[model samples]
Target: MRYSNYIGIFAGLLMIVAAVFPWISITSIDAVVTGFGSEKVTRFGMPVLMNLFMIGLTTIFFLVPKLWAKRANPFAAAINFSWALRNLLLLSTCRNGECPKTTIWLYVYFAASLILLVMSVLPDMKVIEKGKE
Candidate 1:
C-alpha cells in the first residue's frame, strides 16, 4: 500500500464504475443503440474486457510485488489508454454525416484511463550509487 499505488487503484475503480454507465449513444431512425445491450454488446465488448484486465492487473500490483506484476502494470495501462482513445475517437467521429451522442461517462472513462497510464509509469524505482544524491 504505497502512495504510488493509490492512483492506479483509484483509476481502476473509476473504470469499473464507468463500465456500468452508457458509453456511446446513436439514434438511427426510430432505434437507439447504446454501449450496453444484447444488440450492441459487440461495440462495447472490448472496452469492458480491457477494463476488467486493468482491474486485475492493478489488484495484482498491490497484492504481489513481483517483477512480472510490475511489468504487467504498464502493459495494462497502455491497453487501457488505447482503449479510451479508441472509444473517444469512435464515438466523437461522424459516420454517414451523423455523429453519435456521447455521455459524460465516456469522458470520465477516458480521464480514468489517462490517469491509469500516468500512474503506471510513475512507479519506476531509481537506484542511487553510493554517496550519490
Candidate 2:
C-alpha cells in the first residue's frame, strides 16, 4: 500500500516517456508521412503540455505529500486519460474513408495514460493495527 504512490508516479513517468515518441503515423500507397503526437502536433498541443505538467505535479506531490496533492492527483489522471482517449479516437477514426494505420507508439501512449488513470483511481489501503481485532 505504501508503494501505491509510487505506482502513480511510475504511470505518470510512463506517459511522459510515451509522449516523446510518435503517436500516430499517416501512410499512403506510395510513401509514409509525418506522425502526429505530442511532439509532432503544434496546434491544440495543450494535452502534451498538460501531460508533462501533471507528471511534474505528481512528482512534487510525492515529495511534499500534502493533502492538496493527494486530492489533485485524481484530477490530473482524469485529464491525461481524456487526452489519451481523444488521441486514440482521432487517430483511429476516418474522416474521408481513409484512416491511416496507427503506429505502436500510439498504443503505448494510450496504455501508459490508461495505467496512470487506473493507479490514480485506486484507493489507498488502510493499514491494520496489530492485535486490533
Candidate 3:
C-alpha cells in the first residue's frame, strides 16, 4: 500500500506489458500505421519494433528487484523516454519522406510513448531514496 509498493507494481506491470505487447501491439501498429496510402509504415516499422524492444527491456530491468525495498535500483529504473520518442517520431515522420503532418494518431502514439517513459522512471524513485545507503 506504500508508494514504493505502488511503484513496484506499476513497474512490474509495465515490464510485463512491454515484454508481451510488442508481438500483440505490432498487429495494431501495423494495421493503423498505414494511414491513407502511406508507405512509411513499411519503411519504418522495424525501427518502431526496436524501440518497443528497448522499452520492454527497460521495464523488465526495473521489475527485477523486490517490491518491499523502499528505493529503486538506480541503474534499473533510469530509462530515457527521449530515445524511444526519437524512434517513434521518426517512424511517424517519413511517410514517403513527406512527413505526415496530417496524422493525429502519430501524436497520440507519441503521447502514449511519453507516458510509458514516465512509468519507466517510476521504479527509480525507490533507488533515488534508498540505493545510496
Score each candidate by Cα lDDT. Answer: 0.69, 0.65, 0.43
lDDT of 1 by residue, 1-133 (tens): 2466787788878877876787666676433333333254354444466567666776677456566777778887887688778767866677788777777887888898888887876675545699877
Better by TM-score, candidate 3 or 2? 2
Cα RMSDs, all models: 3.6, 4.2, 7.9
Report the lDDT tens digits of candidate 3 across residue range 2-112: 244345445444433442322211333443332122342454444344445554555555556666432333333333345445645554454433443324444444455
Residue 14 in model 1: lDDT: 86
Which model scores highest in TM-score? 1
TM-score for candidate 1, please give it.
0.75
- Name the better of 1 and 3 by lDDT: 1
lDDT of prediction 1: 0.69
Residue pairs with backbone overlap in model 2: none
How well does each candidate superpose onto the true structure, as a TM-score?
0.75, 0.71, 0.44
The best candidate in terms of lDDT = 1
Tens digits of lDDT, candidate 2, 28-128: 44323222233343543444665677677666665455566667777877887887788678666765667766667667777877777776656464557
